[model samples]
Target: MSQNLLIVGAGEFADIAYEYFTVDSPYTVVGFAVEKDYLTEDEKFGLPVVALEDSVTRFDPAKTEAHVAITSTQLNRVRERLIKKTQDCGYTLANFISPRAMVWRTAKLGVNVFIFENNVVQHGVQIGDGCVLWSGNHVGHQSVIGDYCFLSSHVVISGYCKIGARCFLGVNSTLADSVTIGADIFVGMAAVINKSFEDAGLILNGHPAEASRVSAYRYFKLKAPT
Candidate 1:
């Protein structure tokens, strides 16, 4: 019997995965699953919607594997939540590494990973499970990317860096060698991290504007006659 595949979340990413599954993959996509609150459509990508809570019954894991297609736009919270949910329901998360992706033989990859096209995972690097490495990114040698991390496109992670779990590295971001990014941190797009980021919060790119608050307000047309 052919392997059954169920994709969680029904959005743009799901659409991409569905296309890949239909054309490139050998497994059949049985349905889409989502949380009760976010389950909007009766069907997605032309496949029936199966609630994440009842997915195991609707799609048997023994015959089917599931994948979480939630975009990592907001870090790992969305993907992580669905991963735990599907796993707890006795379903295994499937990893989809596009055949077009260039991954070295020595590179280590964990389960449920989504690696898109034109991405390069160099030798000796370790990517943990539940991670989403978007298209066009370069992960350098010996880098340790923790579980549940999300890396957007065109990002460059230099050699030997440690990226913590649940971290969100935005598009075009670059992390220099040996830098340690703490868990739950949000690195904005185009940010260059030359040093370690130990704090876990929003770290926007570029330095703060030098102009004083009042001066900046007036310059931006925010100040009005009182």
Candidate 2:
């Protein structure tokens, strides 16, 4: 028998998770779960959009399982809120790791995680529950990613970094070794974090990027040493 699945958050991630469950997962996605305030649509991907609190009693978590599809683009507030709310309603969160993803045997993952295609999770990396690692992220060894975090595409997390809960690392962002990212922090796209962060708010791309002179020499076909 196929397990009945309900995806949380009916935005873009809901659509993506819907396709993955239908085509990739063995579970049968029957519905979606969202907060009553966020429930503007009646249905998503031809499935009912039930409120998070109503899901356990209505759909029955004893029979059906659920996953959260919230991205970490906006300070991880939505993802963290949904995770706490869902679990409080007496439902066990589900985890979705893509078959195409490369996770090391020693990696530990928490509940309600959605690891997408081509994600390379190295050895001894501890990923907390309700986390979403989007496509093409490279999680380095001995990294501890906290709960309800969202990592976007092509993110490079260097070794031994401690990422706090509900953090959002934007696309193509690179973190240096042993950096401690605080909870509810937002790293902007392609930003390089060479030091630890303790603030719990937005980190925008502050300065203009300097052009690489070596790369410029190579681009102009000059004699740039290898």
Candidate 3:
């Protein structure tokens, strides 16, 4: 495994990723990269901040792997797009599963996933690519979290639950067993989902969650689920 890592993004998430990867993982923080337009800072954490377009030329992708460390901007679309761009730059995407996390042996995670400490991933769980699970979440047995989803800290997704792609689960939210959420859904903070929702682009909130009048897509300024 490559020890050098090029983090894509110079913002807060990038800073957080840099710290976690440097102190907790085997990979060393080599540099930071962002789109040319957003390249304002000269460096981050004493490392060079290069333009993402010139990253491959500056940092050899063969020796330096990359991680797209953007938060759930644009309902995870921005992060997803950046991940693709990094892939186009010929850098192999790296996943960081914190050693403090209690991930069951039967749990499977896809590429570019960022899982923080104190997460309990039960058996038969399948987490998709580009997903971000913040600290202290509980992903129960046989649950499936889809691609590009963001699970905020302390979420409890019970067993057999299925969350669709690009969903943003707010902090302290709890999904009861067998709950199914559709793509582009936004589960609000501290909300509790007890049933199933198959409709995409819905805003689910409130205790014992209810769909909001505003569409998740509309609130996110997206015309539809991408």
Q: Which stretches of candidate 2 lie over 4 Å from their true place?
A: 206-226
Model 2 has a clash total of 0
Instruction: Estimate the overall C-alpha local distance difference test score of candidate 2.
Output: 0.80
Predicted structure 1: clash tally: 0
The candidate scoring highest on lDDT is 3
The whole-model lDDT of each prediction reads: 0.80, 0.80, 0.91
Per-model TM-score on C-alpha atoms? 0.86, 0.84, 0.96
- Supply candidate 3's per-residue lDDT for 157: 96
- What C-alpha root-mean-square deviation, in Å, does candidate 2 show against the real structure? 10.1
lDDT score at residue 147, model 2, on the 0-100 scale: 86
- Sorting all predicted structures by TM-score, with the top scorer first, yields 3, 1, 2
In candidate 1, which residue pairs get closer than 3 Å at backbone N, Cα or C atoms, i.e. clash?
none
Residues 103-210 of candidate 1: C-alpha lDDT, one tens digit per residue: 999999887898988999999999998998889999999999998898888999999999888778878888888988777667778888887866354666644201
Candidate 1: C-alpha RMSD to true structure equals 7.2
Candidate 2: clashing pairs of residues: none
Tens-place lDDT digits, model 3, residues 1-226: 5499999988889989999998889998899999999889887788999999998888999899999999999889999899999999999999999999999999999989999999999999999999999999999999999999999999999999999998999989999999999988888889989988765545556777888777887887886734
Candidate 2 local lDDT, 122-166, one digit each (tens): 999999988989899999999999988889899999999999877
Clash totals for all candidate models: 0, 0, 0
In model 2, how large is the Cα lDDT of residue 195?
Answer: 74
